[model samples]
Target: MKIQILTHTYTLTIEVETQETILEIKRKVEYYLGVPISSQTLSVCDWELLDGLDLDDYPIVTEGTKIDLTINNHIPAIEIRRQIHITVKFSSRKHNIEVDKTETVGSLKEKIHIIDGTPIKQMTLWFLGVEMDEDFRKLSDYGVDEYSEIIVFLKTTSRMVAEPPSRKLRFVVQTSSALLDSTCIPLEMKDSSTVYELRELLLVRKLLPIDDYIFIHKQRIMRENCSLRWHGVENDDYLYIFKGTVSRG
Candidate 1:
């Protein structure tokens, strides 16, 4: 089984047998991280794990279990700084960023833009499954701690047309497959069209199997349930259609 060990600044995945004891797991973590087992406090969710207990006997220690390991030692206030290392997940990509606790959400978004080239206006940050809408709030206000995982979603815009429009905005779709020829087929689509609707249109125009293809915008796979307006898909935006399974790294 795969166990994910999360620390203050890093996340480590380890494979262990079902019969392994909690102490054994601690030893393995110590060997891999160079931290003493005595100094580490391991827990599944919020419940602490006893070192003598066998992992198989624990109902919570199943496959893909996430174990949180915190150091029991205390640091001096004068030497310790109020900063944190967090993982920001954007689509299939994950970026580790070190930020000060006093920094606002808007400032963090700007920092992410500098690193990944994603526009600040289009970025939406979420922590612990809750959206961070108050841009002026400090990171500490949201209870953000070290090694927290923040999800980033990009919003795209659609082109504006004059009143009594005869057609929709044109988009250029390209295929990632090398075997197929790339075509600059101008697809006229409404800004209100859902991603699934666009996928159906691609099936007819690109002549590719519907199930085998996924639409990607700005390197992120567009969710089928959302419309172009939700994604901020603007006029002349490049959408890459890939054949096969999409990798979420």
Candidate 2:
């Protein structure tokens, strides 16, 4: 079967036996591409590839059941080694690591990629996860860890990324000194009590604009119609408040 193994900026394909398992296919591709198995991953949906189902359940690899694979192994090319400095943000902690001159962005991601099993390509990594911007490519685009603190987005979950991060952040005016203009609000509160309930005791004195908006979290973004009352808002989260009228259509 024809398969697409995609990395940050490259995609390669190879024909394989229909009996191959995901883990098995992963190893072969890693070997063929000179990438490390430690850094690569395979993605198959429960319905399409039946992610959790056994390989035997997949039947035989057919002609065009295309499975898109994102190969994350970034290996520094065969070249002289040089210490390149870079600032990497993992969770809430940011660290400066000096890597070889040949390191790829795929390599950098593994160091900070969540162990909970979320693939690097699926995660939206950022400078504080928001604020000023520039979309960052793996080491191929920019050299890192020079000397000073140069902020960058380690990963983008979006493709077609035709452009990098925009210099201006979309801002919405808020009535209080509390709610971030960047924070997202629920679309239609179940009731006035819903809004009051969502805002914590710390936000008791503050009054939200009572606008319909979506609550975007690290894991999920709740629509305005749903309850945002303690669905999970973290301090690390930087919300984007919608300025326009809410729409469900």
Candidate 3:
């Protein structure tokens, strides 16, 4: 019963009961956009209505419904997403980020700002093939597997005169869970990884003492294998990591 609202400006997601009327939905929309229900105009299922219609009518709107509202000329659209993987590129570097597809593009921009170490105001996300006038679909909707290529371009113009002109680049994103794990896990094990894979796995989850040596099951692993599988550890395996100081016994 999930539906998306593609308006002639902004997109939003909302939940509703089966028995609710359009007026009830309008109240919710009013709360979201800070617009009065009396002033709000609603269109469901691509049909333009002069007056509001009950959600319980011929077209049953359910949870995850995308509601569109227009303030002026800008048209905004919303869609329910199962999973979204977007690749962002800027400043000669590329990053792939994944989120629950239900997340809004506006919110996703905030995350890109953190990962790219840039301010949110400076970033704008644009889908190449996706029209600004069309409803945006989640990554899962397009069968974009873990390796599917979705290019995202980033541009920023700083107020500083010394800064260079903004630019664009390409990045690929996928919907695979394993890809996500591999992508992120490498960062945690990159340092001296050849000798401490297993240790990092469990140790990263804990606060190790600065001056203490770390090991597993009495096995000191500083110069040993860092490969997780080398310690007979599978991707899903769990092991305990302990921190201890060298004692003159």
Candidate 4:
């Protein structure tokens, strides 16, 4: 089963087997978070998971369960400054960038700008097929694990130009594992269509059950009022569908 490891600053998902020991899980956590196994404490609902026990021994541990991680020791400032290298792929070239896990998307753009001379305003970053549109959000918030490849697309200078009235774009809509058994629904829509219109189209076609759904394009929660083109959705792009609304507050 897959589970989530939640720390104070970030969250990550990992696949685990029922027969795996807790200590083994800690090692995997160490690989991901750089937190030493000796200083890591994992818990579910405040119940500490002991090292020797297998996941089978814990009845509450199951699929999609969130395990809270606490660092028992203070890491040295030098260790805290350790940066993971990620690949930034542009249209013509790809470069490696050293970045802290806590670095924000906006800061990453600045780094790219310094190295490649691309204007920060002209850059749009994509990770795991999702757009990292929120400037202030940390890279971890977008599930940007170590060595993740970020695709950078440069925007044209025609920002003020109006979009065509009607242009067809073919894309895929992927549902969460909990929804539609993680089905990939192929869709073709006008570029001018808003996300709300996409939802209505799904409902009209009986492709999705009537529910409050949130659309995510390139990992960014899509605005219902905004058109697909405005969201930087390209042909053959994949959009994710989740079952809840985002609360800004």
lDDT of 2 by residue, 1-249 (tens): 455554443354544455656666665444344445555555545234433444556754455444555434364532212346566554555677655434444444444443233454444444322422222344434534455343434455444233222131222222212235334332322221232244432144353544433333332333332223222232234433322221211
lDDT by residue for model 1 over 1-249, one digit each (tens)?
667788765576665678878898886665444456777788987899888888877887887788898776674221233457899998889999877676678667756875788876687789988899787788889988889999998765652222222236678877543325775556778876777888888777655654545566654445576566445567999876644332222
- Candidate 1 off by > 4 Å: 1-167, 246-249
What C-alpha lDDT does candidate 1 achieve relative to the native structure?
0.69
Against the reference, the lDDT scores of all candidates come to 0.69, 0.40, 0.40, 0.78
The total of clashing pairs for model 3 equals 9
Better of 1 and 2 by TM-score: 1
Per-residue lDDT tens digits for candidate 3, residues 83-171, read: 34556656577888655454344334445654666754445444446522112344345444443344445444643223222222111
Among the numbered candidates, top TM-score falls to: 4
How do the residues 1-249 of candidate 4 rate in per-residue lDDT, one tens digit apiece? 777788765566666679989998886666445577888889999999999999999999999898998887577533643557799999889999877676678667767876888877788899989999887788989988779999998788874333225689999999866568899999999986889999999999998998777687754556687678656677999988856443321
Q: What residue pairs clash in candidate 1, if any at all?
A: 156-231, 156-232, 156-233, 157-232, 157-233
User: Model 3: C-alpha RMSD to truth?
Assistant: 21.8
TM of each candidate vs. truth: 0.34, 0.25, 0.27, 0.41
Error of 1 at 131 (Å): 15
Candidate 2, superposed: residue stretches over 4 Å from native = 45-56, 59-61, 70-249
How does candidate 3 fare on TM-score? 0.27
Local error of candidate 3 at residue 22 (angstroms):
1.3
